[model samples]
Target: MTSVQTEVVEDPKGLLNEDDHMRDMERLRMEIVAIRQPFDSVMRVTGRIEPVDPVTWTLPNVAVRIEVESPAGQRPVSRVYTIRRYDSALGEVEIDFVLHDDDSPAMRWLHAVQPGDDVWMTGPRPHFVPDHASGKQAAIFADETAIPAVFAILEAWPADATGTVWIEAGSLAAVDELPEVEGVEVHILQRAKDEAAGTTGRLFAAARSAVADVSGWTVWAAGERQEMRDLRNHFRAAGMARDDLKVLGYWKKGTSSSELDRMRLAEYARMRESGLSMDDMRDADIAV
Candidate 1:
C-alpha cells in the first residue's frame, strides 16, 4: 500500500529559479493526498486514448494504479482510476470538465485541453477497497464522478458474486456510454437540481427495501454531500454493519474540491463520534 501527501500554492511560478522551472512545474502539479504509501511510486503514464467499451473510452496515460502513501498515519491504500480518456490511441488522460470556474487544478486542466493534449498522471495511493461482506452482494449508488471507481470494483468482483447499480444524472441524456457487465442491474435517477429535494430519502427507502431481502448487504453511495450523508444515516439506522458501508461526497452544491475536504473530514469525524455500535443499533433496527 502507498500513501500520498500534496500541498498546493497559488502563483507557484514566482518561487523557483530559471533553470529549475521544469522541476518547479512538476512540483506545482495539482495533487490530492487521498492516500499514503511508502512503496507507492507515481508514474507519469502517457498513452494514446484507448477506446474500450463503446460507452467508455481510455485516456492512455490517464489511467493510473499506485500504492497509497499515508503520511497521515492512515492505512495503506492503492486504487486505479481513468482520470480522463484523452485519445483512442494515446496522450494524457481526458477528463470531463463541466466548464465551471470553481474547479480544482485537475478540473481546470481537463477543461482546457483539446483532443491531442497531454496530461500528467500521478498517484493512486490511499485507495478504497470495497468493504462488503465476503458472501454478500454489493450495491452501488453513484454519479458521473464515481462511475469509474464503481466500474473498477464491479469488474474486480469474483465471477460468482453479483450486484446492482443505481446512478443519478442531470438528465436522461446522461445515460450515454456505459460499460456492459453481466449480472449487474443499472437504474438512473434523473432530476433537475431544483426538483431533487427529498429524492435522496426516497431512494434510500427503495435501497433499504431492496437490501432487506438480500443475504449479505453492502451499501456504497456517492454524489451530493447531503444526500450521501442521508444515505449513510439510513444504512446506519437500518443497522447495517459499520464496516459494510462506504459513502463518498464526490462534490457538493456550489463548492470546489478544496472547499469540500474540510467539510467531509469533519462530517466523517462526527459520524465516528456518534458512537452507536452495530450491535446496539441492530437490536433496535427495523427493516424498511
Candidate 2:
C-alpha cells in the first residue's frame, strides 16, 4: 500500500557526463523499485510531484503490478506497458497504458488517474531479453500492447542494426507514428472487432512478402498464445532454426493470469509430472 512519489535521482556527475556527447547510445536501463514499506491504506492523491532523475526504468517485456478497485472488488492486474518517456528533468516516469471499455480494474484506473493521481508499482523482474548475438539483425511482431516494448528494444539497438517491425492495431488511425530507423520497415495491420481473439490473419498474409528473407535474423514476437503459435509455425516453415526465434504471450484471450495458475495445476495433475523447461521445447518438440 505504499504511496508512490516521484523517484529521487542520485549520482549527478554520471548523469551530466554522458549527455555531453549523445549519439543514441544511452539505453533505457532498469532498476528494481521494490515495495519498501507496506501501505496501511490506499493512496489519496495530494497533488502532483514530478520526478527528476537520470536513467530511470524502461525495458521490453517488463511488467508492473497495479492494484485498483473495480466492480468486482480490489484486484491487482499485471499489465504490459511501454515507457513513453522518462524525463529526468521533469521527474516523471511516463507510461503508455492501453485503455478499454470494460470492468478491467487496470483500464479503469488508467482512465481515472489524473495529473495528481498517484499509484505504487512493484517490478523490474527478469522478463525478456533480446538475442542480439544470434544474428546481426532482427524482426519484431507485436500488437498494440506490445508496441511500446518493441520500441524500447529498438532504442537500444546499434546504429548498424537493421530489421523489420510488424505492428497490428484495431485500425490505421490507432497508429500514431513509428520512430525513424535505417533498414527498419514498419508495417501496420488493422483488426476488426468481430474477429476472434488470438487470430493471426494480416501478419501471416504479409509473411511471404515482408518476412520472407528474415530467416537469417532473429524473430521476436509477443501477443496472444494462438498468434504466437502461428508465428512459431510461420517461422519454422520459413526455415528459421528453433534457436533463432523468441515468442511469448503477453496474455491469452478469455484467460486470466490467476486462473492460469489453476490451469497449470490441472495440467500437471493430468500429466502426472512436471519436468520441462522452455529450452527443452525445440522444433517438433514444442508442447502448449
TM-score of each: 0.55, 0.64
Tens digits of per-residue lDDT, candidate 1, 164-186, equal: 88876554443444565677677
Give per-residue CA lDDT, model 2, range 198-225, as digits (tens). 5655655665467677656787887776
Measured on C-alpha atoms, candidate 2 has an lDDT of 0.51
Error of 2 at 190 (Å): 2.2
What C-alpha lDDT does candidate 1 achieve relative to the native structure?
Answer: 0.46
Give the TM-score comparing model 1 with the true structure, all chains together: 0.55
After superposing candidate 2 on the true structure, give the runs of residues whose Cα lies further than 4 Å from its correct spot: 1-61, 69-77, 192-200, 237-239, 261-288
Best by lDDT: 2
Q: Tally clashing residue pairs in candidate 2.
A: 3
> At residue 129, what lDDT does model 1 achieve?
43
In angstroms, give how far residue 200 of model 2 lies from its true place: 5.0
